[model samples]
Target: MEWVFWGLAAFCAGLVWFLLKIATTIWRKPLQVKKFSEAQGISGPPYRLFSGNSTDITRMTDEQNSKPMALSHDILPRVLPHLHQWSKSYGQDFIFWFGPNVRLVVPHPEIIKEILSTKFGNYPKPPTDPLARQLLGKGLVDLKGEKWAQHRKIINPAFHMDRLKGIIPTIVRSGANMLDGWSKLILLGASEIDVQKEFNDLTANVISRTAFGSSFTEGKHIFEMQTKQMILAVDSFRSVYIPGFRFLPTTKSRQRWNVEKEIRRSLRQIIDARERTAITEKSGRYGDDLLGFMMSESKEQRRVNVKSNGSLSTEEIIDECKTFYFAGHESTSVLLTWSLIYVTRNEKPETKPFNGNGFKWKLALRNGRLQGETRFTHRNAKRCCSVAFLPMKLGRLSIPAGTQLEIPILAIHHDPALWGNDANDFNSGRFNEGIAKAAKHPMAFMPFGAGPTICVGQNFAALETKSVLAMILQKFSFVTSPSYTHAPLLLPNLKPQYGAQLIFCME
Candidate 1:
């Protein structure tokens, strides 16, 4: 009885000590909420201990889909509705607590520019959630300071206009191949198609061809693993606000780890084969694909580093490759998908001009394609050309250190003040004329983002999108299917929550 009592007391003591250590470690970590609130000039209710405002944030996010359907204008309303409401109640720059942390939302374009361009170094990507960082590895999107600078310098030449132009034929070929596949399906009596899935496959193939200089069939397994990884990665983002959750041996974490491992293994094999071929054949001239270009550039850097006593390790190269796969695949696909949706939704038939607008119609469709057609409505004539000056002008917006600024691009693009009353409506006709002639604020439309970090594959993406759309439009007329829902969600990038479904009719 005495021995039993002593053992029980010892166990309790050990447990208490463990708990105290954990509590102390957590309490000592710097709180993120106070600084964030001060910078944004707004405050919310006091945070709950341990949980902070995590419960409220989670509840708000879950209820987001319940909001009444509205025109898909901006993602801000959907992605952060709680923040949107708080902004209205407080101010444009408001601070919202998420768990134990607070994020300052800055909506003004001037402030956005300062954060993105001027003081970029101050706000690094928050340490990625452990699971996500493990899966994604540190790439340009996640890199900061000197690491980011080094990667950017080495990779910059790969995106030069000349290098991009060399891949145009590859882009066109991929689009044509996908279109051919769609035609086969249409012949087999499939009128309704999942355009989102089709676009995904198209982009996947394009990336594989342009990045690997090999058939997508060869890279099919890699694409498959990446697709799974993307879903898992997105899921991790939703749940990541919960502190220490990633370290647990949860099923989600295990799955993510496995997927990441597979992707890395496949990439390593591809890299090894390429290196061997370069060594044995063609006297080490690298292939012209994006991956090949990256390897070639990395090798040059490695040579320089060896001569100068500074070198990046093999792990760093692998991290970069992973980054390329994620960034290159996802962004281009989303942009192309959105562009297609815009074109399909907004395409209007050529119409005869109303009395005095005869010249407008003549200029609108030259050589059976939409070209430069500028018109000056009585209200917009003076402001039309003035729009061109916006991007170059630096407006007054003070930015403090360590502020993470987001370009509320969709908000800017769809704002009634910037784009007139019909801003929410899709109207590519607005761009048929030079953008400067059509936009009330030329800086507002930033599908490719802006400044030095704008997408490297913008031209390739545009050409591919045009080629695919042209081929599809020539053969089929499309209408929205019943299964289509307009619930836009943000997974870092905006996407339709449900797949885009459309009915296709053979022309």
Candidate 2:
């Protein structure tokens, strides 16, 4: 018995030492590596071996807040200090390391335009983690190459101007319903409202009605699961990306797998039910909601395949349906939320409204809505409208073929040089004349992105935003509340860090 006890103690000691060694190695490995320096006209920090700026990126907010700065000045730095500082130190075209990978920060409008247009195919999407892929599925946002092309081809017609106009009533009706709910909440005298959540619900409803031809209450289960999966996927990124990290039988991985299974099962049920109903009815009465269009397209594709010896598999159709549901929902919600924040911050009070002439001039100047008078020199440039696109030649830079270039839309919209001193100011009047005259560069105001891969649901999103905002504006006045945090953080999409708190007084 004494010999056995001694052997067990020895085994435990050895295990402790082995675990300690592994921990030490992980701690010592560098998270980022800077390949070049700002002094050399290369962007970002010098890459550390393994971590590649991960430590600084993670602790950015804490560090930025330790110093004194204006709220606006500190906003971007607190969230993405590396990108901000690097953009300043290195000229517009520079590269930075992000955890053993180089991310080229293309800040110039011309460079951005080139990436979005001329050299589009050169930069494919970066590889998403297996967990992310599982959660998001191979949606249009996640797809690349031939797969993406196929998705674009099949779904493009659904977003055509005519098809979109058919869905306007759906957007308007949904917006009206949302406004009625808000009215009831206001009547209860709620002091502060979280506009972010309001928009989420409103957009969710819009997506459900417009995409699924059903109420959000019906699709709430699927949306909830997707939301959970997104949160888990983002959290899982903290773990080291070891070889086959995804395949490892870890608790988090297993949880994600289970969540994904649930999502897939739920989605399959919805698709199956819709197909069965379509089959039994004989008449197509669902109209142009996203699912209806997709079903119609699938049927056509099937017929074609039968005639031509090939057709899209049911699995492919299901995947596309899932993609539309996710993308169509999330992107529209984010855009509407941000647009609301912008309009609220910029709108002058009713008492302080500018005179008609002044208002017209301001609107024209802000958005470049007025026609003609397009010529201008760099130095003598008056405040042109805030929205404009310009064409320029961008010299070539080394971009790996498969690199997924992220066009930081928010960053571009808020760029100082392009938008003058008050670039960060939220002024919708900047879009008065439309985006064309807003900036010296035409590509500056790409809210829905530009080029071929621009969001397919842009019109639908716009109609939803316009309808909701119009309804809200007609009913209540919105102003930023004291409880509102100014932090605009990106959790896959840009959102208010602490939620958008606003006061709603009856109009």
Candidate 3:
């Protein structure tokens, strides 16, 4: 009986010791990081225990997004209220906690350049979380080191300027198809159309045809599943990063898992079919599409050395395909939508054909450029998950090792000091002088990212945008619908809350 009592006492003491260790880790780690940040003269809103500054961020974001605001080009506050507020208080370089994880906001162009252009070994993509891994997979965006090098080499040929230029007609054809639908709707006396959805469909179709060598219908299911999964994944990001949160059988978790499974299944089917066709078919039409280029390159890699170090497996290829679709589709659609919104607000509609000669056509393209300049509608140029193991000189300070940094793109874009007092205004003329002189820093205008790892499909996206917009401008004149609201929703990207409602005067 004395032995049993002693055993119980020992067990209790051991449990207490274990709890203390956990408490020490949870409490000391963040404080240590915070102390390091403060030592380097960085400060932000004080963090709370365990939750850190997440509650405050959520409160600020929810408050800003709850109400509608006036239609204005200065939307930095609406889209990123927490970052904007903190920037006002803490200046360009400040510290914030992503749920106890310390992150430094390095908005200064010099620092951004250092982060992006430095050796990949020193500053790799920040360690991807489980949620990100589940959604994005280990694609080029998430990969690092030799695997990244290999993927980039293989994917480079597919996005060559010549290859992208060849797809111009397909973009025009896709745009024309959407316009045809709009015409039929107009005949049925439909005067109003949500151009947001229209553009989304158009871009998705463009990606489907260009990347997969398949029409939109053939791959629409994959897009649908991915879109749903992305939304859930974005929502999950805001939650506290507790270990094992993803493995729980919660409704959201289960749904995300199911959706991801479906996406992978669909992508596998598409890849399998393409591989079979490549083997069986004699036509060189396969060379015309991105999938063909990738597959061909991958096959050649295998032929040279079956144990080649750089070659990607079938699963990796599928991840890359999904990455292309997600990156290509939503961003281009947002760009087109915002372009139309800005034009409707700033310029008068033209009834005549816009063949690059019409006043409104030129005006539209200029506004498109401005829209790209001011909007953080797509992936910001922040080096994701990148860290320094040893102290590195960043501007005035030696940034501490293990410091996670993100370039505050939205903050810099709207900074009056950099872009002048009229930075907030919708001035396409600013870019007329070209991007070189648009801002104080040459790297200020990074709509398509910058540095060595800049977007591979930027040229393709640009040509596609130009062709589609030119075709649309030639067919219709449009104004913002009466019901249009100026609420910019940030679902991991800046977008309209009620959609881009437009009254199209189709001719």
**In model 3, which regions exceed 4 Å deviation?**
1-17, 214-217, 231-243, 249-259, 281-287, 304-307, 348-390
- Candidate 3 or 1, higher lDDT: 3
- By TM-score: ranked, best first: 3, 2, 1
- Give candidate 1 misplaced runs (Cα > 4 Å): 1-41, 44-53, 67-76, 215-218, 231-245, 248-255, 303-313, 348-407, 427-443
Off by over 4 Å in 2: 1-40, 65-75, 214-218, 238-243, 284-287, 304-312, 348-406, 426-432
lDDT of 2 by residue, 341-373 (tens): 444444553343222222222222232111111
Error of 3 at 319 (Å): 0.7
How do these models rank on lDDT, best leading? Answer: 3, 2, 1
Evaluated against the true structure, the overall lDDT of model 3 is 0.74
Q: How accurate is candidate 2 locally (lDDT)?
A: 0.60
Q: CA lDDT, every prediction?
A: 0.59, 0.60, 0.74
lDDT of 1 at 241: 61
lDDT of 3 at 284: 27
Give each model's clash number.
0, 33, 4
